[model samples]
Target chain A: MKKSNIKSKHIINHPLFLPLVCLLLVLIVNLIQTPSFFKITIQNGVLYGFIIDIINRSSGLIIMAVGMTLVVASSGGTDISVGAVSALAGAVCVAVLGTGESYRMPYIISLLLPLIAGMVCGAFNGFLVSYMRVQPMVATLILFTAGRGIAQLITGSFILYVKPVQFQYLGSFLPNVPIPTPCFVATFVILITWLTLKYTSLNMFIQSVGINPKASHLVGLNSKMITFFTYVFCSVCAAGAGLISVSRTASIDANNVGLNVELDAILAVAIGGNSLSGGKFSLFGSVIGAITIQALTTTLYAMHVSADQLPLYKAIVVIIIVALQSPEPKRWYYMIKSGISSGRSAREAN
Target chain B: MRIFKKTAAVILAIMMFMSLAGCGNNKAPVSNDSSDTGTDEKSKSIYVGFVQVGAESDWRMANTKSMQETFTEAKGYKFEMVDAQQKTDKQITAIRDFIQKDVDYIVLAPNTEAGWDTVLGEAKAAGIPVIIVDRMIQTNDNSLFTAWVGSNFKQEGYDAVTALENVLKSKGIPDTQEINIVTLQGTMGSSAQIGRTDGFAEKMAAHKNWKMLDKQSGDFTQEKGQEVMESFLKSYPDIDVVISENDNMSFGAVKAIKAAGKTCGPKGDITIVSFDAVHAAFEAMIAGDIDVDVECNPLHGPRVEKLIKALEAGESVDKIAYVDEDVFYAKDAASIIGKRAY
Candidate 1:
């Protein structure tokens, strides 16, 4: 349907339309509430304000959602272990770096090990889902529960600090740079993913496997392999996110590092109108959706929404965005449009 | 095949009966031994079985350490601890295990506020005095436990107000100065959040000139705390003071404040008051990032020790007791940073 040459007149009702509108609506609400919400000022050569925060804070989620989109598309199932994997990855990063106010190992090893740890975790899930024929949810549930426990074992049930100026650069800001470092990390990951999809046959293979695994296998596509690759890649992406978070805080707290982040990543995928059942996906939509989620959170803090009532207000906005994306509202819009057109023709004939 | 199945069932029944008899025999010897030792106080060690919620963070580790160090062979106490690993079912099982062993006392740091009545009742029936620690379990019967010893979150909050006053006096701000304050709270509806917020609010009511600009929950994580602080900075530009519920949040707030080209601490633009005087908070204070820290003490071991001694002497102790806490200024941080147990 997306490839079809449908008339441009229906662009208003396109799949991507409501999500962009939802994002705009949230930002617009922010603008109306606080006129200075969009204002950006330079502090110590870095851009400072709520807008910078929205971009910086959502970078981790955006990276995870991109990986999740492919994972969901390949296996036709969601990976709920991304959050826990990130926590374990963070623990590995800090454990290698040591809790002392210095790096215990070379900086490069600390970075690579977490990604490798994440790959192993993802491979475990991939093996279960693709080879053992287990459901993705059940496969990932093993890591979802045990990952934090493993992390705690590494950190000795403590929030160990890495406290060095250079360590904070990736998560916060680089020396004399105007933008947050996470923005670059996230973009680098997204760009690599986009290039892989565009230049390689991975995009087609994953989508084919997701749409129909047996048919894709019969058609000479390594469907199971594609599914496994997606899980591994997704876990690697989660590890990247873990690195970003660890750098941002310069510390590792297994219990709190990626707490409830899987729900956010899945929610971002849903908000982007990506089917959790798999087949088609939009990375851009998920990115925008992540930004929108961050925007809503910032808006609540800016509005000083009562602490207990914060979730209630956030739920209301989310429900409206989701309702707009649903079929019934668009069905009503098209029904009213055709009714008006017929009435106009009948009046002209009279 | 039917005859084989019957034989298997008979074997299983015998195994089950043997396990039940083994449990009965274990209980008998434990009770008899405890009774035998009660008459010879000088020769026997007082056994204390602690059912602890797992070490989820640095604070919990310190808490477990405090208890382990305080109750030892030198102190004539035999301490046995079961880490619940943040699960209530495990805690209940550990408590029951302690009961079967007939320990003189059972110390429980509950994971949740509910679902401990039956286990506590079992301990009560076994005549073991249960000392509740850290978080309180909700039970209607006050007689279920001997005494509850934990941190007074409200006192920490009240003490923060007093600490802030000292900070203000030193900064030369007048008592009647129109001070603007904001709070980065912990998770909403949590005991810490509710107690600290209420404690601070109750005391703030006495100061007419101090204005609370906003209060938001940061969920007690540095990342969320930073994001919320950024938002708070954007909304209220001329904020004077910040009350972060925990040290992690305070660090995040300090980062946000610094990124916004603002300063904090004793000589900075904003005076930051934080709770949970962790070692990191001491480091932060010494660095002039945080002005003062009010301790939510995790050293319940000494308090529990005192209670045990009182109960041993047949003296009635308070139904609820609060562990001692301290308020440390940045000036004190330099001298006291080395002594922090956590």
Candidate 2:
């Protein structure tokens, strides 16, 4: 068959198309509501207004969601501890680098160490889940509940105000531009991860475990090794997110940094048409989904909705998206298949 | 399969039984002592039931300590402090349990103003004086409690605004220029949120140039405060001022500002101002990270002692007792930070 012949089938088979459909629907509605919404303008040599700001601000979620998608797809597991992991990593980096009177740390070490710490924590989680045979949820739950406490205990609870000029430049934007550094770092990581998955046997093994761990183990695949690496990778991703987060803030307090980010990343992955039950993954879709969620919030804020009402709106949007993306009812789905099959048979007889 | 099923069922049942037993053991059994002699002639020590809002932050811990330290047996009161862990239903249950035990007076720092009138009314009908401390409740009836011993929250907000205005004036910033202010409000519908926000809004009205660019509830946590402040910085590029309802929240905002590569406090890109005279806030101010502090005066220990004394003497005290406070800056509180209890 020609490549064009397969292109039509690809649309129906692909999971990532669902979020694209939703995104289009939202864009169409916005276009109808506000005629000027689709327009963009440059101000003071920088892109301005609600949509741009939303995309820039949601870089952290986009990066984390990409990592979460892989972890979920590979091991049928979720990392609810990423937020705390990020905080702990940020705190560790700051604590090691900071002096009580003034903060001073070399630029490269401050940026690299937190991610390293986060990977170690993630590896710890992986070790328990893969080797110790603990449930992923249970293994990560300890970190989710107590990681921030540990972070605070390590950092002494006060916000570490670091003044290293070189380190401060990591999360800073270009002169007179609104483009955040996290956005660039997240985009680079996403590209690297995408390339790595495409070029490696790790991708196939990860998919195998996700499809059925029993089958992978029977085939002599190193299921535990794959599972362990998946979590470690996820932690590294979260560490990157945290580094950007703390850099964006120029200070780190273990108690409050990166709190509830797990929820945002999970929501982003879900909105990107990834399954909570696990199997398939989409990094690009998750990035768009993250921006979409942030955009919706920014739009709501611009519309003057009360702060209390924002959560309600977020819940409603999530519910609607999840419901629409959910697999069709079994009976209705079978009915449609049977109807199409019968029609095809009739055409063959003709 | 049947044997495995049975084993799982047995284990689950045993776990449930153990948890039930654990909960039963965890609760401290109330002891009733009716045998004490000689003290009965001179008004039995008033049993005080203090249902705290939990140690949510340093301020809450200070508030709890104040109640406990003041309402002691030596001060003619028996204090039973129940930690509610910041849960409303739990606090309500604790209050009901206190009422069942028939305490002389009930002190409550409610999680929120709603769902309180009924409980406070119940305490009132039981003839138990309910002292509202550190925070306020929503009630139309003033007779529900004897007195409210707390700082003038609205005044704290006014004081913050006053300090901000004076600093701006001293810096030679034009009073006519519209100053972009972002506020990290406490828990929504909380007494602190209401009083502090309203006070600042009212005072800033006189200075039409001072405009609130964004106001979001931080839920009184350092994390949410920082997160919201990050969004505020993104939303409003030139947010010149950050006003937090408490020290913890202001500290969170300071982090967000610094992360955004903006300066904090005097001569910085963004000025950090907040309520609560906690040691951390003082330290931040001394370090030039914070510009102003509106004193919330968390040392209500002496006031709690005075209230208990009046109750023991059978003397009717004022309906409300205001805690005296003053606004402080880095220079003003240089020597006093060490003396601060909380």
Candidate 3:
């Protein structure tokens, strides 16, 4: 009993504890609402079911959350421009591919160009926030508003459609393969990010810089460069998510491409137990947080929540989850548990 | 005697305008080009200042295109277009600009129903006839604008019900069979969403065997549509039909259905009834992804031109003009796709 108690306490103290609990609570609600929530089936060699849907749909958000976690850690401000930048990236790819009779560039060129464009955009944001000493929010807001407009210009204010079946493989499934391609891409990103941080001291450097940039600079870390790199990395991740979106639809509508997704990404970071103010962070926690949001959305849809009431319900659930992550609720929870446990121990002693 | 003379003059003008329309496709061909140079050389084209709502979607773009195409240098319209980018302030400013320029006509595609009363009242005070298109304007005085012309969103919903009924009948589904349906709506509270949802629900009440399962807003975007549909599929396995409020959402819904290894279309497990018979929708129909598309026709330029001709001819026109619409099916999409102007 004592060992189990310690293990439970250890689990609660873990950084990912509340995030995972929130995710599990959301999943459990679905299970209670619909018994088949956990059921997965194979059809045409492809995975099909509610749980699979959550994972599949969350792939882009997960990728975005990973990058957002880094940016929030280093910059102490969220990149509200990720969604619009993603839209711009999608617009670039679709534009280069040509929605009309213009010659289609090689698909590889279409893919790489957007990354370069995202790099340029990120460089601009990073320059403003890190080098120019502008507030991160104000620095990023420039691109946030103009990115979609630039995208609209590229697409000529049209919803450009790329009709090649190969173009769609990234957003959907691979030929004769069951799993989604986005899952692979997101995993590739996470793996690279994890390996890079693990093999090198970049993770430590980032944390130190975020914790105290001036102090880290004194310790020989280039705080400005680290922050700038983090922003660039975040934008690239956003571009990758954009590719998934355009692929899924096989088209790009600048207005709605990444619509309000930046909010979700930021929410994921916060839900992952990462402070908006720069500090130490957990990459894995943000991934779980992204998935948790997708689960909540799926659960709401399954529960038949009215369309008008959906946003209100989502806000309510988000408040509860965020409040639970704070110390006050946990303190009360621990107090009640400890009170019961102490009474039981006193009786035993007597 | 004066009233009779005025009525006679109006009738004569209408006849003359109708005769001109019959001779050629273009309506109100301002002062015959060669003949006009001798008389009124200063006013060559009928100046029309259009305050557009922005190129936000394909439908809005097509609507803008229709206006641009109809009002051209060749067609005798000195058209000046200002894209408001969905901002009410910009639209109001554009109208004020038109008022300042003393243009022959002012066309507005308002961003919101509210907040237009003052600007429109100003336009009214200036005696510059304002034609509202695409979306309606709300004001205490209906005479704030000359005419309000756009799709009757509610009718699009009723048309979807009719199309669904026809699709079900063609698939040999009986009237007595219990049919479960769900709706993937557009942006909530917009004219499109409320009109389509309420209209479909009102019509759904007539069918005893039809059951409305759930209605969710997909925000008229492809990504959200797919997400909502995936959840609906998991929740209710027996959903016989999906009424997507727009073509974009239908595209997403079809993609989601196929991704889940389920089929949707005329011969598939789920029959999709979508709005906005865009060129893409026609293509989807031909590709066998969508069953029927209730067209929210965006070719309002000619309709507005007709209204303008009537107003120019001093004939009283209806305050609310609903442009005609049609329902396109997968069977006809192959031929119809090429003919789509958008």
Candidate 4:
């Protein structure tokens, strides 16, 4: 009895277990409906199939979610300006790359410039929220409103098309390689983030600050610095996502690039079974959540659902998933299990 | 606390400076352009206030360029233009400012179709004849504006379907043969998406053999277009034609098709039909990557100019003026692409 209780507790407490189960259920549904859903074929030494597409597409969201998870865990408030900041970063990168006719800068410099721009933008948000003591939502709202406009200004309100083969490799598959470059980039980001959290006290400090800033401060922790650093980290992740997106399309439209992507990042965090109100967090859960969301989109498209009704279908599925993950359902589930077990024990006793 | 306050103050100062710098740049171009035409020409110039829906796309940029080129002091017009930056409230405010300036004529390209009745009524009351361009306004009053110059979005959709039908016939495919088509729609609920989707659906319904395999909104962006098309390819591997609502999405579709190891073009296994005969669309047609392009001409500047000229001469103008456009096929693309402005 003790062993079974420990095993059940381990299953329930596993950070990635719930999302993995949800992803599996989706895959199972797809498999039953379309047997070839899991089939992956190699085309030109690169993987080609529905599953590959989901991984490739979810890379940006996964990277964004990782940073977002940190921010949410530290501040207990979400940043809504990530999408706009991403556009700004992409525009800056493309501007530095310049048009084909006039190569203004080297490729590496062009790439670094955008990432730096993202850091500066992130730093600005951090200053507003941490230093000025402004509400995170309101502080980030300024960037949310002005970020795309700033991006548009950088590009002269025109789509900057990058023609170099080197830039294309960031978004697309490299020569003779089967997997997309973004998948590798995302893996690197996740691994680094996971390792850093594991080795350092940053995660604990962030969680402590989020749970109660005054108490953390009383405990001699630099709670303000911790929160500020999380915002900076989130912005860098968003910049990485921006780079991968622009590389994929080889063009940047300030208005459309990274539009409404912040919602996806936030949703991924929620679906990953992390609390939006702050406290304990899981990077792995968010990654799986991002993959699940992308898989859901892919599954709907494979079913030939009309474009007009796509959002409605997505909303319904998301509602069900969120409901299942909520505390109310979990309590009811445990209650039912306990009741059934007690009734069986009573029957045995009699 | 002191250090935090100092840092916040520095950042706020930088933000303020940047905003001021942006404003300075916008005003510099108008002043320089007007001054370049010589001060003598401004004496008899007809002052026209033009409120534009901001430069969001290449098509919009081209449209704005055409207007700036035509409405110059040298051409007997003093143009004062405001970029609304895709905000309805901004456009209304600009219009109100123009009315206060008492310009000879007010030209507006509304960002949306609603909430213009009150401001437009003000312009009408001030005796400033407003020339609505590009998009239509939702006003119950018929005399709210002088005239509207734009394309019929529904007709553009019908024309796209008609062009596709002609292409199918030329390929020796009988009307009775079953044809599977997928569509990459624009932003949902927007006027373009609604009209284009509805018009095409109406036309496609008349044909018994034309079956719509799937339809998905790309939100009129290349990235979303490519992503949606990638999924479409996996589901409907045997699709014969792709109806992209705009050229941008069509470009994305081409990339997805190639990545999927499928051929897409006029001569390839799949035929691609796209709307908006922008320069890139023509180039795509010439390259045989696009089979047909329905022209939703962005060059409404010249047409609006003509109507304004007629109104200033004390002559009556039509309530609505439809700009003439042509459909392009691969064979004719090469010849027509050079002369195409947008």
On the 0 to 100 scale, the lDDT of residue B310 in model 4 is: 93
Q: After superposition, how far is residue A52 of candidate 3 from its true place, in Å?
A: 0.6
TM-score result, candidate 4: 0.91
- For model 4 the local lDDT of residue A346 reads 96
B37-113 per-residue lDDT for model 4 (tens digits): 34454457877788888877778877788788878767778887888767788889988987877778898888988
What is the lDDT, from 0 to 100, of the residue A341 in candidate 2?
Answer: 79
Q: Evaluate candidate 2 and give its CAPRI docking class based on DockQ.
A: incorrect
Q: How big is the RMSD of model 2?
A: 7.6
Instruction: Give the per-residue lDDT digits (tens) of candidate 4, residues A1-350.
Output: 98999899799868777778788877888998878888898865678889999999999999999999999999999988899989989999999988784467978887899888788778888888877788989999988988887887888888778766677788888888888999999999999999999999887888999999899999999888888888988988998899999988888988888888999999999999999988889889899999999999998888777877889989998888888788897799789989998999999999
Provide the lowest-lDDT 10-residue window in model 4 chain A.
Answer: A159-168
Overall lDDT per candidate, in order of appearance: 0.86, 0.75, 0.86, 0.86
TM of each candidate vs. truth: 0.92, 0.73, 0.90, 0.91
Ranking by DockQ: 4, 1, 3, 2
The 10-residue segment with the lowest total lDDT in model 1 chain A: A1-10
Which residue pairs collide in model 2, if any?
A248-B259, A249-B258, A249-B259, A250-B259, A256-B223
Order of quality (lDDT): 1, 3, 4, 2
Model 4 clash pairs are A46-A178
Off by over 4 Å in 4: A101-104, B1-20, B27-47, B69-79, B97-104, B169-177, B309-317
Which candidate wins on DockQ?
4
